[model samples]
Target: MIIHKSNNVTVFQSAVFQLNTTVVATEDLILVVDPGYLPYEIEQIRIYVDKIKDDRPIYLFFTHSDFDHIVGYGAFPDAKTIASEQFVTNNLKGSQLQAAINYDDEFYIVRPYQLEYPRIDFMIKEDGEQFQVGKTLFNFHYAFGHNHDGLIVTVESENLAIVGDYLSDIEFPFVYFSFEQYGRTLKTLKSIFEKNSERTLITSHGTVTSDQSQITKRISDSYEYLEFVKIQGSGEQFEQFMEEKKYIFSTIFRKRHQDNIMVYERECEHS
Candidate 1:
């Protein structure tokens, strides 16, 4: 369903994971960020973008290498693809594709387009790398933590950001990578917030927010969670920490919180 819409942007939320597919259209370019989840939902995004984008170039920007983020790749064969250099070179491409295949097989869901890993047409190599398409300026920042190749895209023209998995309201930091890396990404995000004026923040898993205080609140939540994970004692439960923060508990998110604990433990050993 359409959660939010503005002059040149429309945000589509999938029922599966509250996964968002953001579309930003202009005279020269139509950018689609991580269009995904069920096959029908992806098709709807494609149809909607196709209808509005007349002679503009379509760009499919993958924020990370996660299976869910890249699962809808084959749906838009004609769109020029975009991703971070790390994502393009990640060795886990085969497993990522298989994860998508596994999801389809488990649910007996069928899709018309072939499910394949995307071949990026444009690659973001460094932080603050800018891509210009007419009046739109896409500033790409490498955001590592949730996934090693995670990216955060900021549309300077719109003063809007498409953050891959970070700064989410629905969930806390899902650090599958490293706690330190996640913290670093949070700092980067905070810097971004400071540099920009009041901005609209679009997260993949949560509702969008334009209020600066709310954006600041999400960043504070991340920093607090990062600190919270560091206090992990021997065999301590993440659920305990979750309760202390008054964060909503769920079986699925419980597993993610546990995984955060494990990642923190591993990072602690290395440090």
Candidate 2:
């Protein structure tokens, strides 16, 4: 599903989880971010890229080392890849690939391209790292917690931030990694949004919002959710903070909420 489209940026959402894959094109370059999910959906993205890419170089930007985010890597063999330095050196490389393979096996899905972890041609080594392609400038910031290797890419040229698997309208925090790091990540995002009020946000799941107010609200929601989780981790649950956000909370995310509590508690234990 093409959620947002223009001459510069095109956002595609997959049926699997409303997972988003964004394509950003400029005068001299075409960039693909986290191409993912089903085989046909990836083909849609691949075909579309070829259609507009012309003779300009194609670049693939993987926000992190997650299976869903990297599932479509095989389809774009000719494109150069970009990812965080941590992502390049991730210890779970095999496990990530196995998860993708497992998903395909369960669905009996066959693809023309081989399933493999993406090889990064360019790595974002530090926060505030800037890379220029043609006339477009990309700013990479560390966005950890949801995952260790996540990087928030700010396309200054497009006034867009491509955040991987964070700030979703349909879900709350899914702390698969460190809870403390996740808390810091939210603070970092809040800081980012506070400064770049004009930038549009392309979260990995759910909505692609350009509204500054909506973007600010999402950051606020995340902070509220994080504090509530912290309260729960302390064994002092006051009326359940999630009660107010029932619109975004559901059975699936509630499960993730429980997981978040456990992750937070464990972090407290070790910290």
Candidate 3:
């Protein structure tokens, strides 16, 4: 269902994981970001796009190569796909992504669409690559750490930032990649927020906020959590931190947090 809509942008939230699918409509073309999840969800996005697209080109942009984010890639065959160069390279590996899809398929007990990786038509080679679609301009920045191929996209006209899988209110830093890289990425987000104070920040899994104070608080919270993990805090400290944040405190996230601690320790030892 539609979560938020303005004059030019519309955001749809999926039932699973609260994953966001954003559509930015312009006079010349329509931009779809991270269209995803179950079959019916993708169908709903397609229907909405069809209604407003009307001969305009549709550009599909994936923030990263996560399975849930790319599950709906096949739904829009005609869309010109865009992603970071790293994301393109990761998708070319095939086996890694295929295994993830297979796992999801088995777990969900459903296969609504033929599971295939995205075919990238446009690759973002640099941090601030700009793409012009008629009067609208989209600037892409490399956002690693959460994942090697992650990206943060800024729509100039809308003053909106679409961040994938980062700055989530419900989740702490997952640190699938390098912990140091994640720290650097958060710094980059801080800089982005500082420069674009008026921009509305949108995350893949949480609420959208235009409040500068809220953005600042989220950045600080994430940085502090990273520090806590880096120092290899005690289990009691971890428990206290979890309670303070009121995180879901589930076994799954707890295990993930523990795994992050192990990875951080190993990396520290190597360094």
Candidate 4:
């Protein structure tokens, strides 16, 4: 667990767990973004929050409701949790938690970690509205397509945005919920990044970026990589493509297995 300072907040990098949790603190409050996997880590985060600003009312915001992102919610009992209405309606309830567990067990070969239903505070902004916590105002932009309810949070004070899985060192995009709008979403994000080149973009998987050129390049590369795979004919062709594109492949290969390969194949066959 390595913690890096991001102007007024701290971003905790979880390499082993493959998630990045961020904490934003103000004089009277603490705002935590996208708590990751591991019940123990969540407890640690709660303890940290309490120690630093005792009973300051931690606000847990879910950028999206993927298994890795929400597993820690159980640890923050007193805090209020907010997320896209679509996420809560579709995937954050009790039955949804069971479904998530089954989904992981069948596909990712992992059991769903325990989860606490967040307070169900509010809906996502319809037109990129802003949510204020104390002195800082965090802008919530609806940038779906990677997932139907995905969001990007921009902090007004730091000139930085916490973009969850919108970009990564990984070559291909892992989108669930909607595939048809994936390309358009990437384009939208690229446009936003271009407009805010001086503002830092923090991805869940890797480094903070201020370079729009690199962000653009990564998105382009990700799309191109997926396109190349889509061009391949079948599952066997996908295997060959993977071998050829070994330069861009990562541990996401074997573990994610059929999902990672089939998604590209589906894009080729359908898109």
> lDDT for every model?
0.88, 0.86, 0.86, 0.67
Clashes of each: 0, 0, 0, 0
Alpha-carbon lDDT of model 1: 0.88
- Once all C-alphas are superposed, what RMSD does model 1 give against the true structure? 1.8
Ranking by lDDT: 1, 2, 3, 4
TM-score of each: 0.95, 0.94, 0.94, 0.79
Candidate 3 residue-wise lDDT, 1-271, digit = tens:
7888989899999887889999989887999999977778889999999999999999999999877788888889989999999988884448656865776767773655677888899999999899887788988888888878999999988999998988888788888777888888898898888997999889998777888998888888899889988788757888888888777746777898888888788778888
Alpha carbon lDDT at 144, candidate 4: 66
User: Candidate 3, which ten residues in sequence have the lowest lDDT sum?
Assistant: 91-100
Pick by lDDT: 1 or 2, better one: 1
Give per-model CA RMSD. 1.8, 2.2, 1.8, 4.2
Q: After superposition, how far is residue 19 of candidate 4 from its true place, in Å?
A: 0.4
Q: Which ten contiguous residues of candidate 2 have the minimum total lDDT?
A: 233-242
Best by TM-score: 1
Model 1 residue 151 lDDT?
A: 89
TM-score of 3: 0.94
TM-score-wise, the better of 1 and 3 is: 1
TM-score computed on alpha carbons, candidate 2: 0.94
Choose 2 or 3, whichever is better by lDDT: 2
Query: Clashes in model 2: which pairs?
Result: none
